[model samples]
Target: MKAADLFEFPASIPFADFFRADALPWQWIGQIKKALASGFETNVPGSIPPGVRISGEVYIHPSVELPAFCSIEGPAWIGEGAQIRPGAYIRGNVIIGAGSVVGNSCEYKNCLLLEDVQTPHFSYIGDSVLGNGSHLGAGVILSNLRLDQKPVKALVDGKSVDTGLRKFGALVGDQAEVGCNAVLNPGSILGKRSLVGPLTPFKGTLGPNKLLVSKPETSIQER
Candidate 1:
């Protein structure tokens, strides 16, 4: 699906020109690096905490709330008013939009987190796009790589389409909610306002405003 279908590309992020609205959603993953390289201006916080280690080309807005301890490796951008909780690990081509929460113990790489996204605890977000207002429950994992190490294919229109990327994760659409301890398999797509129940291992594409629940048996229900 088109990027516009999933994300609005918040105005708070300066690299919007690199991510075209008409482009495919998965295509936006590859643009993360290019976007950072082209427009990123390094502006770190003035008073760095003792336990927080920041390295490489990074930009942390003045209003970003940094925790006491975290490791942030760059080519990364942390937007205004973003909250970086303790023990967070941010590395490589990461973009955190305004007011987003880079939760405690979260590991992020090659990802784009749009405005107001909340990944509030113990999550692994890599090579994925979390849209505006999306929330991930504790221990949510966006599994990026296939076990076989092959290209990740997305399920579009009920057909498998090769995304051509070996490392790809879920495209969590605007305002979506993923429950605690859920594992989103490689190439998963959660449409806008959709919900994935806790403790579920979800894969493929879930449409807008839907709910995927596993009550001993997995089922898709209208939200």
Candidate 2:
């Protein structure tokens, strides 16, 4: 699906030009690196925490709330008013949009987080795109790679479409909600405002405004 269908890239974020609205959602994953490479000044706040370790070409707006203990690697951007909670691990090619929460004990890499997105507890977000206002409940994992380590394929229109990347994660659409402890399999696509019930192991594409529940028999219904 098109990135525009899922996210409206915020104007507050300087890298918006790197991500085109008409491009495929997964294609934006690769643009993360290119966005960081385009060059922006590194502007981390002067008040440094002893437990916080930041290295490489990183930009943290002065308004960002830094935790006492976190590891932030290079080629990353943390937007204004973002909260970086304790024990968060932010690796390369990551973008945290304004007012987003990079939650405690969460690991993020190669991802784009739009405005106000929250991954507020133990979650692994890699090679993915989180749209504006989307929230991930505690312990959610966006599994990026297949066990066989082949290119990830997305289920679009009930057919498999090759993504051509070995490490591709979920594309969480705008305002989507993923419940606690849910595992989103590789190349999963959650449409705008969709919800996945807690502890569900979900794959394939979920249409907009749908709710996927894992009962004795898994079922999808309008939210």
Candidate 3:
């Protein structure tokens, strides 16, 4: 399938140019950091509120809200109306979109969160692009490293295709919902409007309008 089948270009909040994929979609992962840095060339206007520790260079819109204990490392941009709750750590080179929520205990880096995306509560998202309105339930993790610590691969059309990147996380599509405690293995791709059940360890590609549930059936005898 083509890249356009998985991502909706209109849903992108910023850095829309990065979505143009001539070959494989994952090939654009390397360009994310560069795109983020260049956004600052236009004199990005922003302000930093109290109790927030800032390092490097951060471009935060005035309408963004940062609660206490929010630490941001730079080459990062926080969009309008974005909410970074307490204990939210933005490692570096992160693009948090407008009206998005990076909740408490969520650690993310080198990622693009589309508008209205919610990665709240104990989620680890790295080196990935989350589409608009996608939601990661509590304890959901987008894993970036494989066991070998080498380049991650994606299982597309029953083939394991190498992504050629040592650290690459999942590409979650627009309106996808990952249930609580779900772990998305490296190089996973979820198409638009997909659902991942709670406690599932997901890998490979799931097309749009799909529901994946992975849980062992529980049997109760007498109490």
Index of the highest-lDDT prediction: 1
Please give, for residues 1-223, the per-residue lDDT of candidate 3 as tens digits.
6566666654434677766745466755676797776667322335456767888877778776668678888888888888889989999988878889989989988888878999889999998988889999999999999898988988888899888899999889889889999999999998888888899888888878888887664221211
lDDT of 1 by residue, 1-223 (tens): 7999999998889988999999999999999999988866798878899999999999999888779999999999999899999999998899999999999999999999999999999999999999999999999999999999999999999999999999999999999999999999999999999999999999899999999999788889999
- Residue clash pairs of candidate 3: none
Q: Number of clashes in model 3? A: 0
TM-score of each: 0.98, 0.98, 0.89
Error of 1 at 3 (Å): 0.9
Candidate 2: regions farther than 4 A off = none
Instruction: Show how many residue pairs clash in every candidate, following the order shown.
Output: 0, 0, 0
Ranked by TM-score, the better of candidates 2 and 3 is 2
lDDT of each: 0.95, 0.94, 0.81
